[model samples]
Target: MKKEEKLEIKLNVQKESWKSLWLMARRYGMSPEKMLEQFVADLTCGAGSGGSDERDLAERWYYRSFEMMGEDTFVSYLCSDEDMIEEVMELKGRITKSEQYISEVKKRIETGERIFVHYGKADKKSLIAATWEELGYESREAWDKECEEEIREEKEIVSENEERLKEIWENFQRARASQSATYEEEMKKLDEFLEEYGKSFR
Candidate 1:
């Protein structure tokens, strides 16, 4: 194997700026040279190319400090609880609404109550009594029309609920996939950081 040539470069900056960099390096629990090397490497690699695309320069450096940290630990540092909570609440809200709607539909079915149009009748009893034979409806055709209307509405609700369920499932899956991708990217960055940090220590 061929050995790569190493070059030493000296950077000129204001004392205050160097002091700030030194402070940052100390905060990162690494030496100033290692930190500067990382900065150069990061800039060379292009700043938002990795999974941490959303993060800024300072944020990336902060995360680099926890190179050996787990997702749970990284998550705490990232303060992603608000995002997680929002996702959970949205999912719960969707599920609760669906459950409540189903329960109401079941209750109406069990009670034999009118869920759709009243069809000009005061109650279910009157509606049923108003059939063709009872003359409550002008004709059998009129009664069938009302029945068809109710059936159409019931079908519509069923279709709407099916669509709603599908949407909820799709949204949940998308959110989960997004979270996984973000985590995977973060883990990749951590692995790279750990490797670099190890080299710096050696």
Candidate 2:
């Protein structure tokens, strides 16, 4: 796969859970930081039983670094919970394989070029996100502070949470209008979840 620009997301290492991740890290005979890096690489490479679509997997995560969007990106809050790290670890193990990935890989062997498993991703699920953003991002870089500021100003910063919430709500709303996942059965299930869970939130 050719190198394509991606949205970057910076995440802080959870200090409290560092010990636990470190425990796993030490078993590999590496420092906490180094082992964590390797762990991240393996996790993305579909280490566990769950196979992953390599093409879309690249879209979902970066190597140790957060994902990159266009230029006007903004972080609205921090996740203070220690459990978030555990959640991330668990989630990383469940990634699926893709077929839209690049199939050619080049490696040097002593005798000749050996054909090994091409690390190219097998799927292009990332297009979904890129497409959705392209639909609404008008001349705005996905990671630009200026554009994010403008969006904040337009909403007057009543709360960053409001914007984050809407970011998801808007996508689902768009998906619904576009008939992405608005099949009657799914919608009915959603309605059921809403009716059951929504009524309890208050």
Candidate 3:
């Protein structure tokens, strides 16, 4: 694919199960990641309906039927008047510049380049601080404080969502089961009444 080519592509994506993505990836001689990007591009680049909420629509188009691997996100666009190549390069530069902080702060994440793993266990903050120190800046007390607060907020949101979802699902199941039980009991009573009426008629 030329970095500067502006062309429309149509891609058929197998949903979150990722079974079809893997197959397409192999067929295209590219990684599953590359296949997924092509799939998202074709979907969100206005090749088709493009749907509402492009990002969510892309996720659905790619994996609604499949199990979620994780909640990764993507952003795509259609070039209106600007040069697409320049836009792509500028976007890439923006991302790379942000990521440069990773090497300065931490390295080799998951065997490639280390990542700052702040799962927010008690030593996580210290490790992040050390990464900043390596980058020739003492980890700022203010920033560290902000990070801790942010981490706490994240934990609260996750915990709240989990509880809310669980409560709603449990209530749904109970309602279903209760209705089933009531229906069965009613059927049993109807059958008994019919048996008595038949005996009287005889």
Best-performing candidate as measured by TM-score: 1
Lowest summed lDDT over 10 consecutive residues: which window, candidate 3? 71-80
Per-residue CA lDDT of model 2 for 1-202, tens digit only, reads 7764433446677887887877877886778766544445455553332245643465465523553332211111112232432332222222111111111111112221211122134234443334424434443243244334544453443344334444544544553453444335443453454355335432
What's the C-alpha lDDT at position 116 in model 3? 37
Model 2: lDDT equals 0.39
- Candidate 3 structure, TM-score to reference: 0.21
How well is each residue in 82-161 modelled by candidate 3, as lDDT tens digits?
35324333443444454454433333322322223433344645555565555343655544555445545555555555
Ranking by lDDT: 1, 3, 2
For residue 119, give model 2's deviation from the true position in Å: 56
Stretches of model 2 off by over 4 angstroms after superposition? 1-11, 46-202
Global lDDT scores for all candidate models: 0.54, 0.39, 0.46
In model 1, which runs have C-alpha deviations exceeding 4 angstroms? 1-56, 64-93, 115-125, 128-202
Report how far off residue 101 is in candidate 1 (Å).
1.5
Residue 6 local lDDT, model 2: 38
TM-score for candidate 1, please give it.
0.27
TM-score of every prediction relative to native? 0.27, 0.20, 0.21
